[model samples]
Target: MKLAIVVGHNARSQGAVRPDTGETEFAWNSRLAKMIEEEARLFPRIRVKTFFREYCGSYRREIAEVYDQVDAWGADASNELHFNSHSSRTATGTEVLSSGSDASLRYARALQERMGAALGLKDRGVKVRRSGRGSESLMSGRAPAVLIEPFFGSSPEGQAATDEEHEQRALARSILQATQDAFL
Candidate 1:
């Protein structure tokens, strides 16, 4: 199976109300992409591809290219990665979303479980998403795609705890483990 990973916005993209200081969406994306790539090296059956490593303009345009690139590469599955945030400080934990298709839902549930186990975070459970401004069209086609907000990265506790290298690696490991369990 081939997998395509998409990092969030540009390093300078307009962030939400609460953004991570000194950490751009691009930076977080690059880190997550690298982590996933490293783990893919361990699994021989699956190949991984990264979409939109660099940012120009027009997020919609870039996302379209990502979809085309993955489609042309014949990826069996595509995952769009991003961190979550809320206006309220109380919100926490990880979330996985599927297209409500059996396969996608299965992947979402398994991934959510693995991530929760590895991260020791609360389970926000899996949900099906339909429409959105930022949704990827790559998923709109033949490939199975889902958007993952692994944690509320902007949360006060999350930001404080996740700034360290060890914590980041741990989070990455959880994501990688979830990928292995879900796909392999």
Candidate 2:
């Protein structure tokens, strides 16, 4: 399978930040995406490519460019890495957003299950969103895509759960396993 792993947000507009550590979603997920790509090397059948959204001054155009690039690369499946955030620090869980297609739904479920287990977070289940914050990334590409929110960066507990190197490695493995199960 040809997999496109996109790091959520960009350098100019990094997504939610962990207050305590000041770790931005873009930075954290960039590292995770690289780890995922490295892990994919172990699977001979899987070809993984990592992407970062360019801050082109327009969010809509940037997303379109990303989808265009992914489509051009002829990816079979795509996953965008992100972490959830809320004003209430108590909110925490692992969830995946799908494009509402059957393939996307299956992919989302696989990711949600694996990531939840890897992170040891509450399973918020798969959410089908045809429109919203992450909808474009899920629906705009030719390949089936899912947006992963593996934990809430805003919550101390959530941060603690995924703050270690081992946790990140486990999450990377889970992502590849999910891709294999859902798409291969």
Best by lDDT: 2
lDDT of 1 by residue, 1-184 (tens): 7777877665557344336675655677677788878766666776788876345576666667767777888977777777778778778888888887777776778778876776666788887877674455425546877777767766876576566667666666666566666767
How high is the CA lDDT of each candidate model? Answer: 0.70, 0.91
lDDT per residue (tens digit) for residues 45-135 in model 2: 8899988899998888999899889999999999989999999999999999999888999888999888888988898999998887898
Highest TM-score among the candidates is held by which one?
2
Estimate candidate 2's alpha-carbon lDDT, on a 0 to 1 scale.
Answer: 0.91
**CA lDDT of 11 in candidate 1?**
56
Candidate 2 matches the true fold with a TM-score of: 0.97
Q: What is the Å distance of residue 80 in model 2 from its true position?
A: 0.9
